[model samples]
Target: MTDISEVFGFIKDFGFPVVLSWFLLVRMENKLAGLTEVIGELSCNIAAMRGEIPKR
Candidate 1:
């Protein structure tokens, strides 16, 4: 049917970018988590240096 073909065509046109964006977002989430952890560690270190908190 023409409607079925049209649906497939629409999916073909838009699906790749949607899938790719999802994949990239998953990868970026991991990197952002690592970055957040590093930032927290850095903050702790700075606090220790300032004598606001005891060093571990």
Candidate 2:
């Protein structure tokens, strides 16, 4: 079995890259969320113009 210390050592060695990747992922998630909100609003507007309820 691998020792816990070894795991921690590996993380310590690559922590910066891991943290950077997490930061980038979070930023991407936020941007995608904003884009999703904008798309939802646009869809609602289009549906209103067509006199139909947006698909639930």
Candidate 3:
């Protein structure tokens, strides 16, 4: 009984932060992917504006 209680107590203490961290990491990964794509697009646009790239 004490072991079960201890397990629950530990979970209560640490589970929420672990879950929250995992969720935030997943969200950040997606956001970073999107940001990376935007940065690539921006770089191409700048190069095109400077005539470093041929017009499409």
Candidate 4:
């Protein structure tokens, strides 16, 4: 059996918006770092390949 009081009780026990925002921020930072790593790897690969192959 659920009541309005119980709903509020659960919300009081668990802060919703604060937790949600923190979760999103953490994931966004991770994704941004991953993208940076990929870009750096690609840049290095291009430079390496360019050096190995002579210009035509």
Candidate 5:
């Protein structure tokens, strides 16, 4: 079984900044993924208007 103290100790050793940075990175990645999807849709829309094949 895992000990609770071990987990807390690990977090304490690493500090809050590292954890915060990871959190921020994950949030940024999610936002970037959403932006990528929106860009893809916009590109497809433009391609349709131009009557050109949109390279996937």
Candidate 6:
């Protein structure tokens, strides 16, 4: 009960959707970062992946 109460208080002060959006954004950022890391590792594993990162 105390934990729930605390969580509710935090959510109320922060607002649910805002917090959700922030968390979602953070998750998306982390997922994108992970994907980038995997891609980088794959590039390293490839034979000629070391020429350049290439422009975005």
Give lDDT per model, in order: 0.97, 0.92, 0.95, 0.85, 0.91, 0.82
Q: Write the per-residue lDDT of candidate 6 for residues 7-52, one digit (tens) a residue.
A: 8898898898898999999989989999999998787666355556
lDDT of 3 by residue, 1-56 (tens): 57898999999999999999999999999999999999999999999999999756
Q: Candidate 3: TM-score?
A: 0.82
Residue 56, candidate 5: alpha-carbon lDDT: 59
* Maximum-TM-score candidate: 1
Name model 1 segments beyond 4 Å from true.
none
In model 5, which residue pairs have backbone atoms overlapping below 3 Å? none
Model 2 segments beyond 4 Å from truth?
1-13, 53-56
The lowest-lDDT stretch of 10 consecutive residues in candidate 1 is 1-10
Mind giving the per-residue lDDT tens digits that candidate 5 earns over 9-56?
988988787989999999999999999999999989889788797555
Runs in model 4 lying further than 4 Å from the true structure: 1-15, 52-56
Question: What would the per-residue lDDT of candidate 2 be over residues 1-56, giving only the tens digit for each residue?
Answer: 99999999999989989999999999999999999999999989889889898454
Return the TM-score for candidate 4, rounded to 2 decimals. 0.52
Clashes of 6: 0
> Per-residue lDDT for 1-56 in model 1, tens only?
57998999988999999999999999999999999999999999999999999999
Ranking by lDDT: 1, 3, 2, 5, 4, 6
Clashing pairs in 3: none
TM-score of each: 0.91, 0.60, 0.82, 0.52, 0.63, 0.46
Q: List runs of model 5 lying over 4 Å from the truth.
A: 1-14, 54-56
TM-score of 6: 0.46
The true-versus-predicted C-alpha distance at residue 7 of model 1, in Å, is: 0.5
Instruction: Assess candidate 1 and give its TM-score to the true structure.
Output: 0.91
